[model samples]
Target: MSLDLGRTASPGSTPRAPGRLGVPVTAAEALRYLTDLGLWIDARRSQLSAIDQAALNAPDQGDREALTHDLTVSMALWKAIADRYELLKVAFDSGRVGPTQAEQISTLIWGRLDVTPGQAGEAARSRVPSTADGALAVSLPEACRLSDAMTSSLRARLALEPTAMDVGLRVKSIREGIERIRDQIGLIPPGASRDKANHDLVGLEQRLFGVTERAKRGADVGGYLGPLEVDVAGRERDLIVAAARRVSGERDAATARAKVADLAARGDAIRSLQAQCLRDVTPAPKLGVPDVRALGAVPTDADAVDAFLRRLELVSRALDQAHETYARALAEREELRGLLGALDAQAATSPAITEDERADLAPLHTQLVATLASTPVPLVRARALMAAYQSYLQAVTTNVRGPR
Candidate 1:
């Protein structure tokens, strides 16, 4: 159930002002406050009764005694408050007191409800207004605040009891949320990402079944309330919230599709680039591209899809580096070829062809021939050959004419 977060009390209603020794001074102030208290208790009597019985059957003597004492005193207070309301009604009907005055008189009993010693007594003393003005001083809104606190306390106590509250409604809420998320994602086709997401969905469904089963088993079936039971409920609640957030109509689905499509296109672009490099570049280098065939699957879970997108991003970077390396190697081969061609042309035009000159050019020519014959010529060796060719051209020029 959703907790109300608005308007705890009626607006502009005055609470009792503190009086001497923190006790209610006027009967009217006490009556109003006690009336609020009585009504709150009436509303939660069934839950409180269940808790009372559970406490009585509790194994821990300390828990049994404490809960019993608190329940007894609270009931007594409620009854006393009820009795005062009746008396005030009678007085007002008989013309013995005005409606306002009679109302205030009933709240006087708030501080007088007998309580046993110890924690329950201390709680009662602190919670029950004592000052004459404070006794009946709470406005309707303040009373609401008090009622809410009481309801919460009762629920907490009930959670510890074997009379396990019907969790069906909560379970229903979670199921509904999950169904909405499922429907939203159903628009997508089957794929690896979707398959992974479906796997997680299956797990959630199993957990839901487990939660439902345990809830069916009475709290007494287990010795007492344990953290595991609470955790199950808590986890289900979290799932409900998560599913609720994930549920979106066509607009959201469109937006999500747009995002996925953008990422997928980028991934495809990298793959295409790698493929082209492999075909066009001599002695193709490995791009280490991930097998993304699974990405074609439609994703059901947002988280799973997000993770897949991240993997695509990493793969893109790797492909980018590999593509760059391939281009650089290809460029270096072209530049080395241009330099060797220039040297060969210069040698053919040399005015003097000495024996030493021919000898010098012969090995250079062999090295260039060997390099051209090989696929994916070694970059370092090609650069060295280009440098040696340049030096040879310079020597030929110096011998033919003179150093410039």
Candidate 2:
């Protein structure tokens, strides 16, 4: 829409932030509005210029009152629109429209409306759409498209026209593709081939970012976009191809490496547990656990590595069982030893004890000694020895406490 150039800005009208304008706006929206406005003004430049000249030239008395008033309003409106366009253009070129600039823009476009001397009259005659809701609704990409079109139209007005380009959309699509490729790369473990692919993709992203920056600076990016898009597509294809080749090797190797690390940890744990078991056993039986150090050498082949892992698993399970068996038998043996110690103490303390007491205690003490002397003492035999020893001690105590 045309702006009113004759309308004087409000006396106290200081620039305000876009947030203060009570409208939501993104960088794209500002760009679009500015671009569209510029093109619109350029389109009506001749018509507007003629109306302005005629009003200026016409006599005050015979100035065709209707034409005079129309020309005045049109000139005022065109100027206002142009001023807004310049404000937005500067903001757009910066590639960023922070809240404050955005607010200034919205206020300039929709907040100030006193373009004509007679506000009431202008309001009655004007049919311009209220920008209250419009500014906040426009998005950044939409803003870019609008701005790009305006740039093209302005250039055309001077016969220096440039081809239109949708650089924003291309850049956006390429970026999305890059992100997807990155996610795929995450699934594949790091390696030489993947690193090379990643390096190439990174370079491509930088080039695309540059293209976007050039577009923001009002460069004719139409030619640049095509080559960049092709490069992005090709790079994306190469990345996928690269990932495909390396993924199997990297993933398998990664998985194998993980298995090897796990096996190593498990082997250390099994060895520790095996040592514990040997210590618990009566004679510390030789743990037949194949040397854990031998498994440290991982094979390069996937199947061979997998087989080695299986062997480790089997060894771990056997060692675990050995630990349990030895620990149980050890607990029993310790209990039997305690009983033997009690019997020997009682025998030594009571030299005057009767023959019957000695006979009963002798058999119990013999059983305890036999059980303790046995290598890798069996849990069942040790339990029986402890029971017998307890019975003998209880009988002797009862006899000593009898009426005699």
Candidate 3:
């Protein structure tokens, strides 16, 4: 609900341009499709952190490990993002198509507005259309905000993470929210306060997500470096008090202004006093707090919650860094696994593949490399998984496709 829906002007929002067959969208239109991406990500990051904190608090090792998965790279983050875009494209491309459903699905890759609507459907989602002057149509989802499609794709490859349907549902919910907005736009007036009301606030975050840089500097809260989340509860109360003041004429207005000034001054003093008190209060010893440096001991029992989270954080941070290495490894591993799966499927269904690196081309080598370069990792789970999987793939296909 606290989504800071940025105020970026909608780009290339030429109301459904003339695409080949499906939605005729420009590259920039995609940028306007979502908003507050950072806030959404921050929320997810918070969820992950909370999960780690919970695991730390759990009594049993197995329970702790179960909760620990929550601290890992979100299983759905990538796929959810991609699928939302996919659904967005689908809703837009609903009427667009060649002669078959397969052809329509191919258009999912994007780029084909100039293909002369006639030929657009013909090419279908087949050969990705190269724009004039020759360029790839759109860069696949690469930003953070862990999407469902990417994670689903990631899981299918690794076979290590949970394969819950909730992940899929979570993504569908987001896209549905977006689609609902587009559906309702024709009914609502733009810029009305109401336009911003009654929404998940997540959809609006896409506004500046892909186009601008977002950092959680404004949203993130640190224990040692920050006060308890600004309490904003008090700020809200003060604002209400400020708003509730009665002012009829000039004199009443003046009186209200003076009261507000006094309240502000008092609030500032209160904050200063509170800070001073915090600085002076002696923290009770938690095994080592009082004798921290003197006894060469530190707070080891950071409570169960804090201790578990610290471990999760350590592991998560390491995994977040190694995602690229892991992702590339995952892609390669998926390809190998797919190849093997297809070989088995074909071996059962028909004769062997002839004249091909792969034995079964029944699905016919779509061979698209969708790079989830921005995928997130709870590092703890992903690091060991990727290392082990990558090592296994290397042992099997050492001479295969080089690191994607």
**TM-score for each of the candidates:** 0.33, 0.34, 0.18
Residue 199 Cα positional deviation in candidate 1, in Å, after optimal superposition? 24
lDDT of 1 by residue, 1-404 (tens): 11122313332211332233234334444435444444444555655566677777778887676566656544544444445446544443433445454444444333232222234555443443322122322323223333233333444454643355446644664465445336534634566745755665676677667666776775332322233333333333333223332432222344546655665565577667666555544566665654445456545454454455566566557656765766665666677777777777877887665678788879888987687557656656666776787777686678545553
Estimate, for each residue in 1-404, the C-alpha lDDT of model 2 and write its tens digit.
Answer: 23333433321111222333457566766655554554555654554454445546556654345445444444544555555567666655554667776666666554533233233244323322112121111222222222222222222222232244355755676676567557655755567756876787788778877888987999976666655555554444344333333433344456656765765576566667666656555455555544445666656543455465566667557656656655555565676677678767876777556788788778767867876776656556667777777776766665645455
lDDT for position 124 in model 1: 45
Error of 1 at 86 (Å): 53
RMSD of each: 22.1, 24.1, 34.4
Q: lDDT values of the candidates?
A: 0.50, 0.52, 0.32
Off-target runs (Cα >4 Å) in candidate 3 are: 1-24, 34-36, 75-404
Instruction: Order the numbered candidates by TM-score, best leading.
Output: 2, 1, 3
TM-score of candidate 3 relative to the true fold? 0.18
Identify the runs in model 1 with alpha carbons over 4 angstroms from their true place: 1-240, 247-283, 338-381, 391-404
- How many backbone overlaps does candidate 1 show? 28
> What C-alpha lDDT does candidate 2 achieve relative to the native structure?
0.52
